[model samples]
Target: MFAMLRYAPLLAIPAFSSVAWAPPMIRMVLLMAVAWLTVIAAPSLTPMPYWSDGGGLLLACSSELLIGMTFGLAIMLPQAGIGMAASVADMQAGLSAASLLDPGGQHEPETLLGSLLLLAAVVLFFTLNLHVQLFHLMAESLRVLPLGAVGLRLDPEAFMAMVGSSFLLGLMVVAPLMIGLFAVDLAVAYATRSMPQANVYFLALPLKIAAALLLLAATLAYVPALIERVFQDALARLPSVFGA
Candidate 1:
């Protein structure tokens, strides 16, 4: 039990960071405590494979920790990639200038699009009951990959596929805004070409901003569906992470 407790922090770190509403420290503590209690009480509620001695017990605990960390990483990687890609897109779109630091992400510059993605992720997790599903999955994984068994193995190809999917999702989410901004730019260019005396840069800036805002407002309705798909994909790919 003490050994499992030591590994609880590893399990908590990724799950806690993924949640947007909870303070980082509080999330971490909550998840760690949950993991600790789950492991400590496992023997009483379920049949645990018997070990011969202290040496066997030590090996079992170490293996459990490794498996927990691997499971946590599988969930965290996609979210981290999505957040990073969203930040890049926001920077390219000139939206990074007015970013606030995000405490959950270690004070990184939190761009508008990044914040939206994070919020969407959080909403989908709760609304779809993904939090409950994820906890159930974690418990099931323990049965399949028991203590003293080999640690869960990640498949590189599948992981890369998920990463690609996450990037594509991010692009799709921001595509409407980009397209609107591009149209505004083209219109401004045409106006400048027809009337060479005009100051196109100054005139186009507000137009671009207004167009972006309008498009964003219009696209708000589709956001819930997009978020649901992303969360579904995240959950669907869980088995692949453990090479299942």
Candidate 2:
């Protein structure tokens, strides 16, 4: 339970187990209760030869915690990709100023285009059962890197590669929209220059939003495929990312 609790937030990223909105005290109590239940239900889940001197137990706990964190982080990379795509699209659409406080207590940009895309991404995530896949990956990780066996054995290069690839996937998802928005920007610029007295900045926002929405609606069919590909790529890299 403790091990799982250490990584619960990571597991919660996909919306299934998130408790970030709860009061801190309530959240802690809930987590502790869950952890206790988990331990009670699965005694073997803990590190072998659990009883030890204080220093040894501390080392064991640290190693297990590290393992949980690594697995959790690896599972979270694809979601980061989703956030990246939304952020860039929001920026280009001039919707960066529109913001919301999410359940995690973070201020997130909230735009029509970005919100739509984020919703699509999340829907596809659940549709593809990637959350289940992540759970399985986490389980597999335990087999490959057992509790208290050692500290995380991540390869820096592999980790960087995963990060780079995830970001690239995000860029790919937003590429077409970006190009369309860029053309819109050029048109707006030319129009503004030709008519110096016009409120072009104000005018551009609506135009950009319209174009982004149109493009998004037109290309909506392709989003599932893009999301699926990114998800699969992330799943494929999970084993290497966690040294599984």
Candidate 3:
């Protein structure tokens, strides 16, 4: 419970285990279930000697907390790239000013395209059963980096590469939309140049929105592939978070 609570917000990025509006009891039940399942998977595992000492127990708890945070952040990076792409798309489409209904039932308004992308991404995530793979990774973490175990190993280069890839993901996903919108803006400028007295803002707004929607409609067929690639790459790198 403490471990998961440490990075619950990060986990929400991919909707791995977050049910933001669900009752607290349900959330606790879920954490309990996962814990139970982990133990069941490694029935021979036992508490570390640190459990008998207050200071060692604290250190163990801290390690568990760090473990959850590291994993949660690992999941968030690639998905956050998808989210960043949605924000960029909204801005390029001139839809940044429009608010979308909170599809997660948070009842808060978000960027229009962001909401759609997040909803679609979450649906695709579960459809691909990446959640199951992540669940398996969780179990693997226990065998590889059990609670309170000292002498943790890490690769700073791998983590830095993960960070760099996240930004790259955003760029790749939003590139098409950005290019289409730029062309639209250029054409709209040329068309309106002769009529400086005319209200070009009103005219160009609708054109940009239409072109944006059309471009997205045409290119959306590739989104699932993009998402799958991003997550698979992230998952492959995740083991480095807990080991060398």
Root-mean-square deviation per candidate: 4.6, 4.5, 3.6
For 39-87, candidate 3 gives per-residue lDDT tens digits of 5665374666767898987776676666666666666677688888888
Q: How far is candidate 2 from the true structure (C-alpha RMSD, Å)?
A: 4.5
Best by TM-score: 3
For each of the candidates, give the backbone clash count: 0, 0, 0
Per-model TM against the reference: 0.73, 0.77, 0.84
lDDT of 1 at 206: 60
Which model, 2 or 3, shows the larger TM-score? 3
What's the candidate order when arranged by decreasing lDDT?
3, 2, 1
Rate residue 139 of model 3 by lDDT.
Answer: 71
Off by over 4 Å in 2: 1-7, 12-51, 100-109
C-alpha local distance difference test of each model: 0.64, 0.68, 0.70
Worst 10 residues of 2 by lDDT: 12-21
Ranking by TM-score: 3, 2, 1
TM for candidate 2 is 0.77
lDDT of 3 at 54: 87
lDDT for residue 201 in candidate 2, whole number 0-100: 86
